[model samples]
Target: MRKPCWFLAPPVSRAARWRGRCCTGGWRVRALVRDPFSAGAAALAARGAELVVGTFEDRAAMRSAMAGVDGVFSVQPSSPGGTVTDEQEVRYGITIADLAVECG
Candidate 1:
């Protein structure tokens, strides 16, 4: 059987759409969400996604979320949104990429 694909963002974002597509395509999905109880996360769960509560800043959570997954869809908030600076966004992307490799 194919391993799960990990999504590194909340289901409310673009990840939600991709998650649905993945589900329909017969791929198991695992999402890293900040709040598992949120409506978006709940919707994802209803659609068969395994939700892991974490943010990009949480290395341990990211590692845990990536465990045993076949691949990852890395997504991070960019600058001007104020959630993260441009440098931080780049760093988060790189970090997720590195972790995906390490997990493999």
Candidate 2:
């Protein structure tokens, strides 16, 4: 087998050049967005790919939003006006991951 394409942003792309989902020979691709507009989601859906849109900001809300998803892509959401401390960001990331695993 060649490899799995995991488009996990710029940093993670070196390992896997993530591309849109292709069902031709067992290729699966997905994108994590805060929301999936109908036009884009419909286009991706037409190609037999999935676009996960978590319609929430809070952890519990996001967990609920992604309740049935197989895997989760999370970012600790940065704000220009109010940036979180590194420690806080780490904790937030962990919380999201744990919650996602729990819900899934």
Per-residue lDDT of 57 in model 2: 38
TM-score for each model: 0.89, 0.43
Candidate 1 structure quality by residue, lDDT tens digits, 1-104: 47899887644566567778876678888888898898888888988888888888899999998999989987687658676789998999999999999999
- Alpha-carbon runs more than 4 Å astray in model 2: 1-57, 77-82
Worst 10 residues of 1 by lDDT: 8-17
* Candidate 2, position 101, lDDT: 66
TM-score of model number 1: 0.89
Please provide, for model 2 over 1-104, each residue's C-alpha lDDT reduced to its tens digit, 9 standing for 90 to 100: 22222222212333222233332346554544444665545555565555556432355455554555555544454444576566666776777667766875
Going through the candidates in order, what is the number of backbone clashes in each?
Answer: 0, 0
